[model samples]
Target: MDNDCMNNIEDRKIIYQLINFAIKHKKIMQNYLDETGVYQAQHRLLMEIFHNQNASQNHIVKSMDVSAATIAVSLKKLEKGGYIKKEMDEVDNRLNKITITEKGKKVVEQSKQIFDSVDGRVFEGFTEEEKLTLFLLLQKLNDNLNSMEDELKSKKERK
Candidate 1:
């Protein structure tokens, strides 16, 4: 095979591996998310709020890399479910500060235990050092991909 063709084939296999891994872990993650009655994407927002209470909706959407509409819809659903509260900023009413409700806190506290246990069990065979090394490698790969994405975007903008 030509070098380009070989690279294409390898890329496809890498994509397949990523999707397969996600499918395998979906069951483990979905069970916990379902029990909490939140979608996976919404859980990302919840986790963000758990760490950064009274966070601005715009900040959350930017950090989460989701569209404003998507974030708004999710926030509305969560608010209706009594998991979150959106309050107007004291100085700038244009910006909304989102806070996790007591109910949301309880959910996170319980779900965190489930998530931690699942993560531990998933890599039970790996030593602590192995886990750390794998994490660092994955982080490096993720950062490289992000940089490549930015480069592509810049090239497109120039064109």
Candidate 2:
């Protein structure tokens, strides 16, 4: 086969490996989250509220790039579970300010520990040098992908 064809095959293998890695990682995370009694979406929303205390629902919807309805549903679940509390905004009565409750803060801290442990396990067999090399390579790949996206957008705009 030609050199270009060989390169294409190698590229496909790399993409496949990346997809598998992502799937496996997700499964592991899901298993851990299950043990914590928090759904992945709720955990994500809780983390956002933890970091951005007193944020509005609309702000979370915008920041997360999700629909308001989706955020509202998660918020309702979280509030019912005592993970978060929604209070009427003092100045803006129309908007409710969302804040993480004490329970939610504990969950967030536990989630951090869980994530750290999982991350450590992920690189269990890798040396420090290998980890650093992988980080650099991934960074470069992300930069290249971003550049490609920008170029595509520019082309579309031109047309």
Candidate 3:
């Protein structure tokens, strides 16, 4: 096979590995999230809010990469459970800003501990340099995906 074809085959294998890794990671995290009385999506959303207090619903929807409907459902559940509060944006009554409550902060702390432990488990044998390289490569891949999304959106707008 030509070198280019060989590289293509190797890249496909890498893609497959990445897909499998994501599936397994989700499954593992689900158990942890469940124990904390939140779904994986909710946990992620909570963490996002924890990082960005008083963020608008629209911002959360974009940052979480979840549908608006999904965000609504998750926010409702979180709010009902007293984990978060949704206050109307002072400048924009139409927009609701999400703020984590004291209860929600506790959850975030717990989740952070779980995540830190999980991270250790995932990278137990990896050296510091290997971990850094992996982080950089994943970031590059994420950037490429974002660019592809932007291009697709531009094309759609042009059409």
Candidate 4:
């Protein structure tokens, strides 16, 4: 059966396959994190700040699709690590902006290379077109998953 068709299957055998992929990939990423001396969420925040020094806490909260408290914890951890700094926005006392320090920028640069290598290794043997196809497919899968979240919430309300 085709891959997408399998996703519509009974007993969710396809869901189990997706879980295996997630588990295996999480293990791979955990290995990378262990070698890198920090967690993935911290790494992501640094990367985001590297690209946008003016990033706001609310922006990170929304982008990460996580709680503001969770982002605050990560932000505080990064701040304590000297990887980033938070400055209050001049226009709004309620809004704070994040910026990556020079050290943080260096770490981000190094992590980018590491992640690139990881991706290359993960997709090794796949042709460039195949890689693009996989990328598009995953993008669609992610969109579908996100769309289901609201449906799941509504079902829980009914329950």
RMSD of each: 4.9, 3.5, 4.1, 4.3
lDDT of 4 at 59: 90
Could you tell me the lDDT of residue 96 within candidate 1?
Answer: 97
Can you write out model 3's per-residue Cα lDDT over 26-98, one digit (the tens) per residue?
8897788688887778888999999999999999989878899999999999999999999998898999989
Write the number of the candidate with greater TM-score, choosing between 2 and 3.
2
Clash pairs, model 2 backbone: none
- By TM-score, the better pick of 1 and 3 is 1
Better of 2 and 4 by TM-score: 2
Tens-digit lDDT track of model 1 for 59-152: 9988889999999999998999899999999999899999999988887887898888888888999998999998998798799999999999
Q: After superposition, how far is residue 92 of candidate 2 from its true place, in Å?
A: 1.0
Span of ten consecutive residues with least summed lDDT in model 1: 6-15
TM-score of each: 0.80, 0.88, 0.77, 0.75
Winning model by lDDT: 2
Q: Per-residue alpha-carbon lDDT of model 2 for 25-133, expressed as tens digits?
A: 9999989978767899999989999999999999999999999999999999999999999999999999999999889989999999999999999999999999999
Candidates in descending lDDT order: 2, 3, 1, 4
